[model samples]
Target: MTALSELNDDIVRSMSVGAVFSDFGGKVNSLDFHRTADLLVTSSDDDSVRFYDTTSAKLVKTTYHKKHGADRICFTHHPSSVVCSSKHNLDNSGEFLRYLSMYDNRCLRYFKGHKERVVSLSMSPVNDSFMSGSLDHSVRIWDLRVNACQGILHLRGRPTVAYDQQGLVFAVAMEGGAIKLFDSRSYDKGPFDTFLVGGDTAEVCDIKFSNDGRSMLLTTTNNNVYLLDAYNGEKKGGFSMDSSQNATIEATFTPDGQYVCSGSGDGNIHVWNINNEPTKVACLDSYIGVPTCLKWAPRRVMFAAASSVLTFWIPNDAKPGLESGGLNSEV
Candidate 1:
């Protein structure tokens, strides 16, 4: 295993641009990058919302979530709206965020309706509409045009959601190995299709739509990942990680859709080539613990992974560490 010092030096030197804001002594649960201002918005167990400059790596602002700790945070595609959720107890004994809180100049407006804690939140890739998934087993769509709940579709179980590129279709992965699709135009009535995953019976942990919205990726608690056809809900291919001792937490497609990167419970990030035959491209072995989250930057040719600490990875243009070739050569 490489030492932390060596990993830090390699990342710092190879990183064309990055940031390290470690003021929060707690784990960062979620992170989102604002495209317009090039600001990074991060939420952690420390109950703080931090904004950092993506260019100069400077701390811009810090705001508390009104004494309530945040679990997940996301920015609407619009530059004006921000949404955040409170941490939820595993035993369901404590108060969680029942509504999505929109922030503007430190003033917050709650979009209340769900009876349970909000587990996942995402913004439409093509519009100002946003979607939220709750433990109440429902997905709700919110439109900023009216600041009200435009539609709600109940699922068989709690789900994680992602929107397609056109903002017309949304995918929700339920707890019982099922993924449902709903059209924003017809979301008020019902889902268009409910697709069942094969192989592992573990609950779906995360889901993401490909860059072109032609495919979707699903990660489960059983170290298995599946790529599905976005149109008809047919399985294109699937892969399982032998090194993943624990569940796969999240999987995401690179900007070009040639690779899929995932964070596992074994304190490592795995990259897979999805262009031809799917294979393990690289394994990022720098993280110290289970990576709670991962985010790919929009413009930069880099990505960030978060556990107890936030780590950035840029292409090793000189000498690549893994057998997958240098990041620059591949990306």
Candidate 2:
């Protein structure tokens, strides 16, 4: 097996676009990587889902969701299944999250509850339990093993949700830069801790915890990304760039937690070298315009971004240690 994530300053700076897949007829809305697999998957406005083998930067399969229309998607704890939110409905299904089996093309289960669109969906890191935040002003928790929602929270404004590395707790980001933390086992009890992101007044776009559970990253529609202490909510630092209307630019952390990267309205990939004392941010041009959705591979030194096209980033090995990066086939 490949060595556990070789991400570093040299590898990140030497990185360039490795491969591009323009397979979507519409914009790629969401993408995710399997927890322990080299596989990456995306959901698109074209009403389809596509999976890629990150090892080769190659397409593995494509499935259509014409009836419901796929949007925010996430891989469940199982390898061959995923939970997807949909914008279109054939009957009175409401805005339901569909649990699908990729290999057999079967709807393993349908989780129903949200009255409005589900804006954020996250699969648990350790089990079948998952959670969703909806525009209807509520957050619901569900388990793949059960057909019904296990818990729900009614809150004001749009919300986004994420599970920490250990899955022992989860965080919810609200409209006023307020973040609430809850224990997964007893989430009905309410958030044990709440922290305000000092200056960002824009609605929270997405929230994520670093692999070490030490830091948190939050983004806003106003084109700002902030890194904070996951435990104390102390602001570490953040940066902003050109604005994109109504777009949530996601910021992701490398597996080693040394850096964070995000896409911007100006069609550039912004990399923040946070490990440095001064926190330097670099910009690299992107072929996929408005590359709003981006993610770093959970277990590899590679990263992927998308719009209507999906582009993979890998180290430009001519300087040194290129082949050892593991995603060389695309280069």
Q: Would you estimate the TM-scores of all the predictions?
A: 0.80, 0.93
**Model 2 per-residue lDDT tens digits across residues 1-331:** 2333566666677667777787579988899999998888899999998888877667888999998899999998777789999889724777478999999888988888889888899889998899999988899999899998999998879989999999999999987899999999998889999999887778887888999999999988788888988999988888786787755577899888889898888888888777744265567788877887999898877789987788887766532222434333332
**Model 1 Cα lDDT, one tens digit per residue, 39-104:** 677788787777755544555677776545677778776544567776644234333432333344
* Global CA lDDT computed for model 1: 0.66
Q: RMSD in angstroms, all models?
A: 7.3, 2.7
Give every collision pair in model 2: none
lDDT (Cα, 0-100) at 281 in candidate 1: 59
In each prediction, how many residue pairs overlap at the backbone (N, C-alpha, C within less than 3 A)?
0, 0
Where model 1 places Cα greater than 4 Å from the true spot, the runs are 1-19, 35-37, 88-105, 145-147, 241-248, 318-331
